[model samples]
Target: MFAVHRSNGLRFLRSGTRTAAFQVRHSSTFAVWNPPKQAPREVPTPLVLCSASHWDSGTRNNIPQIFATMLAEKGHTCIEVDFGLPGDGEMCSSSQDLMDRLSEELKVNLHLSGSPFPPVIFARGFASLIAQAYISSHPAQGLFLISPPPSNTSLFPSILPTPLGEFDYELKFPVAVMACPTEMVQLRKHSRLGQDELVDLIEIDNLEGRDAFLRIEQWLDELGI
Candidate 1:
């Protein structure tokens, strides 16, 4: 059963499978119940940055902090989740667990915080798969890949046991891939991703020894994000 009060001084009532309408009139001073207005939706905070390090390196190597600092300077919140290792044993299991948590956190925070802001995953080397797999299942607003190696490369072959051909599944959002000139050449030959799949393809002159964080910042500016 349901009842609705109409503005024309009428009350509509529905009982079981029957509907009835009645008019309720009173003096001009008679008070009437009014539905409360819904609160406005809140704007979400800045992106939650997920930073992953190389396969063999530890998170304490300062790489995550460096990137976080760079983003922080631009008024973005960056969170680092360290997968720690690349092998198929403890590190792999731990990384998979972290991915699950990230998905859960994004869901919970978005609802409880009353914000729709989505996160962006930034990964390098072997930990890139952790980001990719998480995004594949949970989906994010954006993805940023830096110097990602081929799925079968020596550095992190086991990181993505699946062949590149199998990654034909469409992603839910935009991706930005930044690779060194050398790495870009290799990626074009072996990677399943193409320019069309990415929002932008950035080529860096030197990635092995140089800091190309500024390029990422510039790209973000271009996006007006």
Candidate 2:
């Protein structure tokens, strides 16, 4: 049993047995209600925008898919897109053009959801370069790059478009990297890799199964996402 009284732009709630005061602030379109002793529920995980080598289902592998699947299992809404470079005869300009398209898609999705929070971008291999480019203008909660392609390897030589140091990456928000020890070493050659500006480097080989999930969750926790 409770009673609510409204007067002078304020609402007061009084329980029959126990009287408790509540403050309600009214606005043009909504009201802000603050209740006491409300139990916290599970919050929907921050949306994750994932990208890999290509968009086609047939050409795709299971690597980036695994990340999206795992993130979904952890309660995140993961959207996977293909920002990979076209393999000749493709109409798209590949990198920049794909990122612009992705940015537009993200804006549309966020608007439709009506959520003020922005989604984090997750990229694997060469697609990380695209993610880095997108986050420069459009703000995001975070950026996670897994196993970004090495600069000079047995398969490709001088393949990286722009060096990591040259990329216009925003250091305001957190940026995480999950790569092999050798890959991290390779990245250090191009970028001034260190533990600053909310940048974290995790040795992917060190994380396995539940441990990997926990590490990412911990990062989100620290960021208050």
Candidate 3:
């Protein structure tokens, strides 16, 4: 059993290294993920981290927003982190350096949330790559990768490091991969980690709409997270 919240209060954080924003959303209110941290308070939701494709790109559908809301409604603090990749204006010398910066900021936020260590993180695409890089060395409650990229994509070497070739996340904690029909094959072909035992692969025709949520929710139920 975890801290289950049925409250309507939701808080989202969109943060950068030096700049941070906060927003608290109640029913019928529009909220931005990267709002200034001075919003009116309500019942606090449990805190969890979620990373999505840059700028809500339609390439992966709107699963990012859906995932955030689903967790928020259940009393989890659904923080939507807008992280940047190597060429996405994230001025870092290498992937490891970027991960270190993010890791530091995450630890600080974890302390502020009063949540347990090794948080459950949901990440997608390039964000998923970064998430894996973080979890490889850190302990985590769970890892959910949405539409993950293969380890050996033609473009990966430009952004990722060599040591991540093995990935080996399954040895650290529970891992899951949620992919649409389009991305599922490549995941199995190039990224063997998406295998049944190593990682739970929930294949969907499309990673949008209500059906996608139900499948992902079912997996969470199975994991008891």
Candidate 4:
């Protein structure tokens, strides 16, 4: 899914004897569509829901049947893959490896494994940092960070991991962030910078142990799903 064209001052990374840079021609903005239907309407793209709390992609609790039911009701196709560690029958590896594997599996050129989707939504903060590093190497269309920990140490108390490197968040795309007030404060203070940054932070009250399915539904509705 990548192409190599000679460009000035462009150093191509070599994998084996072939050198290439990853690139995908993003189609014009389009909306998601429900399945078993004929025409594609103006709806958000299919939500590749990532798991949360170190759970595998196929874990029932990670996705919650309710969320699936709601998405089905809305007619949007939800493809939930197991992005967690191995031993669960899903592809098990580091966040970067998993991302590369996922990109190949999904037949997309974008790098998604190292973004906030897997770590914040599935593996917590430290895992998210690993994901961030991967994204830095491979770019993606959007990002979604859900209820990240205050610090990497808070999530992984035994090992203190380093923060992710700098990133450009000015790309023209929609970034949706959902977090509890407390988590939001911590993320704002540590992770997210200005209000006008890459993502539009949506702070929800009473998020402690709250079901995210309903929130996701509401989010889709607001987006005109």
lDDT of 4 by residue, 12-116 (tens): 344332222322222101111134343244233545443333432232333322343345455555433323233235543443454344334333311222223
Tell me the deviation in Å of residue 145 in model 1: 0.3
Worst 10 residues of 4 by lDDT: 24-33
Give the Cα-based TM-score of candidate 4 against the true structure.
Answer: 0.50
Clashing pairs in 3: 22-35, 46-76, 46-77, 47-77
lDDT of 2 by residue, 140-223 (tens): 888877665543232232443322333555587788887767878877665443334357987766433566667777877777
lDDT tens per residue, model 1, 85-175 = 2223323244345445444443443343233556666666554555676667665667777766654344433643333323344755767
lDDT of 1: 0.49
Q: Which segments of candidate 3 are over 4 A away from where they belong?
A: 1-49, 52-62, 85-90, 157-166
lDDT of 3: 0.56
Judging by lDDT against the true structure, name the best candidate. 3
Where in model 2 is the C-alpha error above 4 Å?
Answer: 1-41, 55-64, 84-102, 105-114, 150-165, 192-198, 206-208
Predict model 4's lDDT versus the native.
Answer: 0.41
Q: Evaluate residue 30 in candidate 4 and report its C-alpha lDDT on the 0 to 100 scale.
A: 13
TM-score of each: 0.57, 0.60, 0.67, 0.50
Residue-level lDDT of model 3, residues 1-225, one tens digit each, is 112222345543333311223422211121223222343232242324445344235465445556665554443455555453333355767555766666555444455555454567777776676567677776777778877776635334664553334455455667788887778888788786665576788888767667877876676667665
Report the alpha-carbon TM-score of model 1 versus the true structure. Answer: 0.57
lDDT of 2 at 52: 47
